[model samples]
Target chain A: MPILSVKDLQVTFDVRSAGSWPWTPPRKLHAVGGLSFDLEPGQTVGLVGESGSGKSTVARALVGTVPASGGQILFEGQDLAAMSPQERRRHRKDVQMVFQDPLAALNPRMTVGDIVAEPLVTHHPETSRAEVKKRVGDIMERVGLLPNLVNRYPHEFSGGQCQRIGIARALVMKPKLLICDEPVSALDVSVQAQVVNLLRDLQRDMGLSMIFIAHDLSVVKHISDRIVVMYLGRIMESGPAREVTLRPRHPYTQALISSVPIPDPVLEKARPRPILEGELPSPLSPPSGCVFRTRCPKAKPDCAEPKDRIQREGEVQVACPYQEVKDALAV
Target chain B: MKLASGDAKLLDETAQLASIRGRSLWADARGRFLRNRAALLGLIVLVLVAIFALFGGYFAKYEPDYVDFSLMGANAYRGVPSFESGHYFGVDFDGRDLFARTVQGTGISMLVGVVGALVAVVVGTLYGATAGYIGGRVDNIMMRTVDILMSIPFMFVLILMLVIFGRSMFMLFLGIGLISWLDMSRIARGQTLSIKNKEFVEAAVATGVRPFTIILRHVVPNLLGIVIVYSTLLVPQMIIFESFISYLGLGIQEPQTSLGALINQGAEQMNNGTLWMLAFPLFFFLVTLFAFFFVGDGLRDALDPKDR
Candidate 1:
């Protein structure tokens, strides 16, 4: 069974005014709109796209940090949207997040031990102090922290160490589903591989499930089982990681993949790489019909008309007027 | 061999636990604080002032305002120093010891300064923290109120308070504390706004840490260094206000000497050509005020995280 599933998740942020000036109205921006996805036990699903993809917004809403405007979040066949505060607090013990910025994410004043032990102490307050200390030490060791160094403050540690502190903080509970929101985005290039490899080993060893959010497709392809492509508060494409990386159908995904520098000179010179034509349309008032239609080279007159979403390639789906245009072109 | 292995493990565990309590927080703060030369000097001077206050009463045989006729004219035309051997600072016009009363005035001035500043810091922290953290219209309203209050002349307000409360310590506290606390509130509000949304605070939220505890534990610790620096800086300001009220005779009454009130008393000695009366008390107040200023500046420079 899927460990967690989200159906038509919508979150809209009311930025500023509550009332209307005749032309302006309220500046209600749609940060995430009608997005849906799922994760099974012990699986890592990578949500990949460029910046402002609403990828992080979806992750935050799943962890219940951001309030949902509409839709259901099912965790272990239970509706998270309907859960009471007490039930939600209990549910959160099994799912947690490690945000992108390490120094800002971890409290600067707290010792590494306290930051790691906080979740354990909070959720399982009944645990004895001795056990809590033991658990903190064990997790610190598991995350490659020197046991003697646990009392050091966050500022004393480097960026990568701070991220390790963040990971230890999230992993101490041995949570079933971890939300890694660009965990390596803020780290040094050399340290990125170490942190990524550590997470991969921990997931495999602990049978952990995660929804890894990142703009780095290459990094996502390394560890993710499946990939979900997001574009301007909506999912544009999702499929098996290798298939999506090798042969992307969506124009945005194609631009993103080709931009990933090819090491081989022959293929790098040969492929007809499409450079992105324009800036991503603003999420606040996205283009009607298919949101990506304005940016798609294959846009048709019918693409200007809303082509209600269509299913393609087994369970994969695309909303485009040119679905049959590609067919008619005999490619 | 198995028993020996268990004993080694137990020893290692005990050492690990012992390391956690290697130093108390008090000891750490104190050690860091003492390394700062200015804080050390400020602490020493403050302690010495307190010591003088406690013991000055025991060594005094005469009242601070004692009037004696026999020695009154003795110094009038002596053409030499008068023979009052025990008065370290020579006598005043009425043959009162300038030394003994100056010593007495330190304690009273301190009592006023500390009590007044405490009221200021407490009121300011609460008011500012509430305004900044609650934010929006509430912050706007409260800050406007602060602006209105800041514009009114503080001395006029002090005199008004004096007129209402009749020169009591309560009135002195109310007069100075109510005015000076505005600065504290502003500092606290700005600092609180920056820190109240940090991850630890969010972590506290996620863990079901109550709102009040979050403010007290998380918010307050981050503000402690700035608060301490401001508190020291405020002492001299409070002393100056107390001095002003007392100098104007709107502070502590007769026989209850403040440095301010005594400065007024010493001015009488100056009017009668007794320079010793004015010199001793003025010198004492000057030394204390300068010391407080130096300490305040040193603390501001030293405790600043930016300086590091």
Candidate 2:
């Protein structure tokens, strides 16, 4: 069974209308509208999207940071939405999240050891202090931090080191599933590779399932077993990572793959790229039918009509009907 | 055994590295505070003033209320800070020992300042943190209430409380404390609004920490630096407020005596040329207030995270 199965998950926020009276009703912003995905044990799924694509919202919903307004979040065959408060707390230990801003994710007032040990202490109150220390130390070492530096504060460390500390804190609980929301996007280009490699190594060693959320497709492709492309709160394409990057079926996915610059200057200049036009439509009034239709290069009149079914082309689940699997690398 | 030796050497090296690089936020702040010469002087003055308030009474030859009829007569000029008879600060118009009265005034003023600030910190922090953390309508209502309270004339309400409850220390503390927290609550709420949205608080929530625990552990500790700086500043404000009320004869009552009341009495007899009474108490009061301001300024600089 999949470790986590999120079926038709939705998250909506109530925002006050601009220039409205205090008593005026609020508008509904559908941040994550009907997102569904499954994570098998030990497999990593990369959730790639633009800035406002609701990738972070999905990660937060899974970790229970933000409440899911609708649908079921099934973890180990148990629906998390239906669970009691006590049961939800019990399930919290199994799913942990690493946030985007590393330094901001750590309590400035707390020592590194205390920050990492917090999950263990909260979930297993019966565990002794010594045991908590040992576990925190082990996790710190596993995340490539010196075990003796646990007494240090978050500000004392560099951004890359802080990210490792954040990772250690998330993994200290021995959680089955970890959600990383744009984990390395905030780091320097040189340091980003180190963190990505560390995460991949940790996942291999622990047999951990992960949902890696990022706007950068190259980084996501490096670590994800499968890739789910989202735009304006809906998934446009999802398939095996290699296939999704190379043989992108949806126009939106094709645009995204084209935007990632190749290392070789010659190939990068020669590649034919279709740049997406215009800003993302506000989630408060997202485009009808496929949310990506407004930005899709292959947008048709039919794209505006509501289509509930996601068509399957082999292992790929694509929302767009018009786009064929053209050779993405063809010069 | 060889592996154990290697591990021990590694541990030693890490310890040395830690000493060089692992200064905690508090330790760093402490170093900054120590480096500040004015703050050190302020601290010393505050400590000395506190010591005098606690033990200066023991050195006085006469009680605070003792009436020396000899000094009240034609020999009143003898009350001018004579080395003999142990009247080091001379005498008040009533022939009471100025030294003893000043000591008593210091104690009461400091008490009022500390107790009042304590109440403000506790009540304001909890009220503000709850309002800010819960947010939305609750935050709106709570903060508006504070705004409404702040709009009212603070001294008018304090005087009304004094009139109704009759001048007692408890009522004075309650009056000052209740009003003072309005500003503190506003500060705490503003801080909480910013802190609640920080990723660490969310991380705590994601780690299965209860909301209240997150407030207490994560939110409150982070607030300590600002709260402490504000509280230090609050102490002098409380002291000044109490002194003003006492000057108006609505605080501390006679015989009990605060610095303000003593200063009021001294001002009344200033025409008699018994300036020692006013000089002695005013000196202590001014010193104490300046000391508190210096310390507060130093703490603000030391604890400011932006500086780090």
Candidate 3:
């Protein structure tokens, strides 16, 4: 059974009018509409999407950071939406998050020890100060940070080291689920690989389930067992990482895959880069039926009509109506 | 079980961390502050002034308010400070010890400045932190109230408070503190608004750390640099305010003297050419204000993360 299951999770934000008219009704912006996913224990699910695709909202909603407007979030068979304040707090201990921009994520005023010890001190009040100190030191070392630097402030560390500190803070709680929201996007390319590897190692060692949200498909591909592609608050395609990257059915996913640079110059030249047309439409007024229909090359009149069905082709599930026909024609 | 295995490795690594000397943020800030020459000088002067206020009266042999009729019989009631007469500083028009009264005034002025600034810090910190942390509609309402309060003339509000409460020390302190807190609260609120959104606060919330804890530990501590730097600036302003009010006869009435009241008295006697009367009190007040300014500037530099 999946350790965490989200069913039709919806999140909407009310954006007030920028104009002076107070009587104007506030518009409801659908950030994430009817998003669903399941995370098996010790599994890494990569939620890949461009900015404003509501991928981060999904991660935040699961952690209860951003409140869900509708649908159910089931963790260990219990619905998070139904949980009381006390129960939700208890649930929070099992799920922890590592944020993007490591330096911004940490308190500049705090020492490394205090930052890592916060989770333990908050959830496990019974733990002694000495034990916390000892544990923090251990976690720091595990994350490749020098334990001796416990007293140093966040500004003293480099970007990569700061990220390691962020990871140590997240892992100290012994969380079953770790939501990494673009954990390496702010970091340099060399540091990105280091942090990603550290996360992978920690997940293996701690049996942690992860939701790695990122815009770069290549970055998530290495860490994720499964990949779910999102576009303007809706899922475009989802399947095992290998299958989705190799045999992308959705035209949107195919375009996204082609956008990633291939290292080999010869192969890069041979690759058919479907340069997507038109900018992403605002989430405030998304296209009817298929949200991506406006930019979708294969979008037809039927694609504009309301459809609730999600068709499965092989291992991947695609929202497009003519996905199978297109795949058969390609063969 | 897997977690325990990882923790076991952590225990072994603990030995390596013991050699590192942990430097607190305060200790680091202090180290930087000490290196600043002007700040160090200001600190020394402040310490000397505090000692002088506490015990300088004891240095003078005569009582602060003792009137000497014998001194009036002579060609001059106010005598130049002479060791033979045991008068360290010349007698005032009332034949009171100028040195002792000056010492007494130091205590009163310092008390008002320190206490008033402290009150401002407390109220401002709480008000601004709450406004910034809560945010949204609550923040809007709270900030609007601040704006309304800010729009009112400070002196008008102060005089009204004094008129209602009477010109007691408590009322004087409250009036100064109330006015000073407006700026402090605004600075704190702006800082809290920025810090409240930082990922550390979010991480604290994610870890189930309560709102109060987040404010106290995360929000307040980060604001200490600006708060402390602003506090130094506030002390000098408070002293000036006390002086202005006392000069107006609305503060520090007879018997108990503030530097402001002393300066007011000295200014009246300036026509008589008793330069020392005006010279000493005005000099001390100016010196104290400058000390605060120097220290405040130094602290601003010291506490700035950019400087480090």
Ranking by DockQ: 2, 3, 1
Which residue pairs collide, candidate 2?
none
lDDT of each: 0.76, 0.89, 0.86
Each prediction's fraction of true contacts recovered: 0.19, 0.81, 0.74
Say what the interface RMSD of candidate 2 is: 2.0
Please name the candidate that would achieve the greatest lDDT relative to the true structure.
2
List per-candidate RMSD values in Å: 4.7, 2.2, 4.6
User: Runs in model 3 with CA error above 4 Å?
Assistant: A19-24, A84-86, A324-331, B1-17, B22-32, B72-77, B151-157, B160-165, B305-308
Candidate 2 local lDDT, A1-331, one digit each (tens): 8988989999999899679999888889999988888889999999998899999989888888788999999999999877766778888988899999999999998999999999999989899989998999899999999888888889999999999999999999888899999999999999999999999999999988999999999999999999999998888899999999988888888888888888989988998889889999989898888788787777888878887748898889988778689666751
TM-score per model over all chains: 0.85, 0.95, 0.92
Which window of ten consecutive residues has the lowest lDDT sum in model 1 chain A? Answer: A322-331
Which tens-of-lDDT digit does each residue in B157-207 have in candidate 3?
777777778878888887887778888899999999988878788888888
Question: Sort by TM-score, best first: what order?
Answer: 2, 3, 1
Candidate 3 per-residue C-alpha lDDT over A1-331 given as tens digits, one digit per residue, 9 for 90 to 100: 9998989999999899777475687899999999888999999999998888998888888888778889999998999977776779888888899999899889887888889898999888999989999999899999998788988888788989998999998889889999999999999899899899989999999999999999999999999999999999898889999887777788888878888888888877875666789888999999988888898777888788888648887767888876642221122
> Which candidate gets the maximum DockQ versus the true structure?
2
- CAPRI band of model 3? medium
